[model samples]
Target: MEETWNEVLRDLSVPEDIATKWWSQIMVQYTESARIYHTMDNYLRKKFEIYDIMVKDNISERSAFVLAMFFQHYEHDTNVYGDSIDKNVEHVKNFFKDAGINHEGLISTVVGLLGAACESGSSKEGIDAYFQDLELAALGASPDEYVEYITDIEKEYSNMPAHFYRSLRLKVLQTLLLIPKIYSTDLFYEKYETQARENIEKEINEVLK
Candidate 1:
């Protein structure tokens, strides 16, 4: 049994399910590898605390994970982790699809996650000040104007991590563009309204974008 487990760990790139099991079984509490694994678990826990809030809903969780994988790998002009993008993205996408969600809403979901994550780390005073300006600006803009504003911001932040932040910004833009269409159009609104909080989603999407 120990030999079989060792062989599996040697192929560390085995499926996540297999990896999880092997780690759980072979890396017992007092072992050296187990200590390293638990340390990693703690790090992931801390990093994903904001992620948990962002993905409070199961659908959002799945989608955010998928989008993260996609951007982390396929985002253009990324300054970090460029060459390995394709392989990483493929690995992430496979993880998501393998985990069960197979679709496009993940982008929207991830934008919300990033927003929540960002907001969690900000001071109340800072967030209040930022939102005051944001609210005033939002009230005055049309959908196209909003998109233009986001694009401008996107351009200003040229050094953004394309996968994580930049891609998230784009999705937020897409959601903002999509909201008016979602609400004003009876057909589109009716279709998605039952499942998603259209107005809230729109507002949150806009704020993040």
Candidate 2:
């Protein structure tokens, strides 16, 4: 994953020294002891896999899209909802500023995508839609994988009382199920819609029960 991340930085013409430094800092956050579900190996790496598939499919704005993915979860706070979005956006701005990468348009697009990540609706179009679907690809994983995902997330929030955690978790799942389509892109929708819905419903009924 580090090699692939460095390759992405190289493609963007970031200095190797700067890329190495940045990666070290990012790893510190991702590898924190409290990170069970959001670890680099689990959540972020899965998002990268989705990004790789999108790359093969010839998505546009590749630079901003990829950079956004790298920073999307750069700062996650399990105790808070939606706070990481703004922190990550600021982090991206400072990173680009420090790297002497003056492409404001690229930075703006990345920041916008980061903010868009918090949106509950998939009604967003184009790159935003793809990004939203990519962030949620786990929702459609195979049954066993989905169960593992749930368990890992539960572990991450273990600091909270089990009853409170389940209440919050149930509300989130119920909200996602209410969404018209969990995945917006035609590619994702066609491929994962049924399975994602089944996964969510099964979780709500069996696991949350």
Could you tell me every candidate's TM-score relative to the true structure? 0.25, 0.92
Model 2 stretches astray by more than 4 angstroms = 121-125
Error of 1 at 133 (Å): 19
Candidate 2 lands at a TM-score of 0.92
How well does candidate 2 score on lDDT at residue 201? 94
Tens digits of per-residue lDDT for model 1, 1-209 = 23433343344334666546534532342133312212223223332342343222323244344234223312222344344344445544554455454445653444333333213223323322222222223223455544554454445355665556656655654554564332222332344343334333454555566
Best by TM-score: 2
